[model samples]
Target: MTSINVKQSGDQPNSTHCRWQWRDEELVLLAEKAIWRPVSQELFVADLHLGKAEVFQACGIPLPSDDDRATLLRLETLCERWRPKRVVILGDLIHGRLGLTDRLRADLRNLHRRLHAEVMLIGGNHDRGVQLGTLPQHPACRVGGLWLSHEPEQPIDGRDGLNLCGHIHPTTTLRQGPDRLRLPCFAFDNVEQRMLMPAFGELTGGHDCRHRYRKWLVAEGTIVPWFDSAHSSRASEVGR
Candidate 1:
């Protein structure tokens, strides 16, 4: 099976995205594009965009209507695997106001309503004006000295921590000769002191990573280590 290695500072050899010491805590960056904090027993997923396909269809765009179902099934699998005490969604739970059709809302409500973990939603720009209907909304949520938000904006709640954000749907592109491959990624901006998680929603789009950040691209059921290219962060990743 393919695996992702998370090396801290000078530590090397091998370890799955299982545990990276961050903020004095162990972070399990799952290959599935979610973060599992074993200490807190919390799972973090971002940019679910539940009804995104419906939103596109409403505009007469052709998109499979089952995107939401597929997305939720993944979430259910993660929850079953980790069984976290809490699940915090960084933001963009819905694509837009129009995406929340009655069926969509009911499905969301049912999913959260039955999950064993405590669910929290940080309102994203897309979430505004949508009827969340008792989905445990918050403007920003703080967890383990990290500021969790939908966007990379500064914390408005006057609290402080490293930012864990989504909405940019960060991705990294690899090029060799004439072939180009693009994959979703977990990108960290050291200067800005924030990390952007890849979009959890399967049907979502991605924004390219800026050269300044270190990237770990998710492809083929594993996190592809940064290549030897100029934009690479670590020397560990070999192109697969």
Candidate 2:
């Protein structure tokens, strides 16, 4: 097992952002909105829900058509920066089959052509409606000592590894006096040994998860590790 100690940046209390150490690998929680594993040369993004805007538009709901474009651009920027060998998407690659417009398909195809990294998608509940040819699909995959999946589930009977998943679209709420702030966050359940990724989709909503385990809030181009009120004073102290 691996352990984490408090990480300090310069002289400031840098509890908001830090690399995640697991087993024998060190993973970077990128501000570009994805997990970058330098050891494996892979990037993990979850709950993309591509084509989501189209789904809403189909239902006569006025939604921005540029939603997918924005999501793809963010991904492309990350790809350009990290230059990973593979980009593993946890799930919700597409909102639905009907929502997969030709333009969206072309955009994805172009993205795959432009980037050197291989993109792979794992099926999720929302993925059931996606056409098979829209995106390459897999049930699950193994990365280093981690099990990657769309839904947060324990690995098969004998497998022993930390599970990384994205389905609930975890978010965290911060309360200060009468003011409160809610933001998408990466949630880690220490007891279950699982990590929940925030949604990468531009149009998808988030589910607020304000439980006790560790949380990394993504805001304003920075990833912040949130310490509860009880432990706020010790935020500078490191060690898991």
Q: Quick one: best TM-score, which candidate?
A: 2
Residues 190-226, candidate 1, lDDT per residue (tens digit)? 7777889999998888997756776666776666555
Off by over 4 Å in 1: 1-16, 155-160, 227-240
In TM-score terms, candidate 2 sits at 0.86
RMSD of each: 4.8, 6.6
Give each model a TM-score. 0.85, 0.86
Q: Which ten residues in a row have the lowest lDDT in candidate 1?
A: 1-10
lDDT of each: 0.76, 0.76
Measure candidate 2: CA RMSD.
6.6
In the range 1-240, model 2's lDDT, one tens digit per residue, is: 232333323454443346889878688886656898888799999988888877888899988888788888889888888898988889887888767888878877766666677888888888875564646778877776888889988877467878899998987655444454667888888878898989998887887765455778787777877656355333322211
Poorest lDDT segment (10 consecutive residues) of candidate 2: 231-240
